[model samples]
Target: MLLHYLKSSLDDIDHLIDLTKKDIEDIKEANHELVFERTKIKNDLVKAFENKKSLLDNELIKMVSNNKGMDLESILNEEQKTLLNEMKIKLTELKSVNKQYAKFVVIVSEFYNTLLDKIFPRELEGYKKANRTPATLLKVRA
Candidate 1:
């Protein structure tokens, strides 16, 4: 069961990496359909990965409770240890990819906001602005 959980988690990370890269490509190409489709799959994989990680953690805790003296390294076999290492590496890669995706999203948001501001200037709208209060509780006479 331990090995199964580790392998399944690793597999999820692999699929996530692929899906993330594909989404980046789709975003670059302006393929909305593929991007949305892959986003759903990626979200499902993320949930599965979280579930497998939780299962693995529970099993490890059980093992520790059962065997008071032994540590995790001693409890896991060589294969499980290798899979855990691989999982760590793949998770770092996934983090990097996710960072890229986040940066892209920010850029796109800024571009749209700038475009809207140019096309329809807020000053010309002649509408009363809301939320005029300061963010903090301090009162200023200026």
Candidate 2:
């Protein structure tokens, strides 16, 4: 039962990581649809894992603590250990990919801001009225 829950959680993380990778690709391609899809996937992933922390912290902890001084590795089966390790690796990859995506987003935002500034001119001097001299003929008529 514990292994089952752990595996399920790992699968969720894998799916999230896959979606994040697709998000990066979609960003590069400027695909709005795929980006929206990735957002939905991210929300679903968050909902799925929202309530599982207690199970991991309480139930899994109790189970793993039963083997005298033995750690989780000594208690878990070979397949379970392998799955846990794989989850860790996938998590690390996800972190790195997220960082790259964030950097790309920041660069794009800065480029957009610079473009807008050049076109719209943010400084007050750009909007100031031109100075002009009054005609002298109007004074003679008065």
Q: Which of the numbered candidates is closest to the native, going by highest TM-score?
A: 1
Report the poorest 10 consecutive residues by lDDT, candidate 1: 129-138
Residues 4-117 of candidate 2 have per-residue lDDT tens digits of 666777878778778887888887887857787678779988677545545655765786777768787778788777876776797788789889888877877798877765
lDDT of 2: 0.72
- The CA root-mean-square deviation of candidate 2, after full C-alpha superposition on the true structure, stands at 9.6
- Please give the range of 10 consecutive residues that has the lowest summed lDDT in model 2: 129-138
Which regions of candidate 1 fall more than 4 Å away from where they truly are?
Answer: 124-142
Candidate 1 displacement at residue 111 in angstroms: 1.0
* Position 134, candidate 1: lDDT: 39
- lDDT of each residue in 3-104, candidate 1, tens digit only: 889988988999999888888888788776898888778888999999999999999899888889999889888998899899999999999999998887
| Candidate 1 lDDT for residue 122 | 49
Residue pairs with colliding backbones in model 2 are none
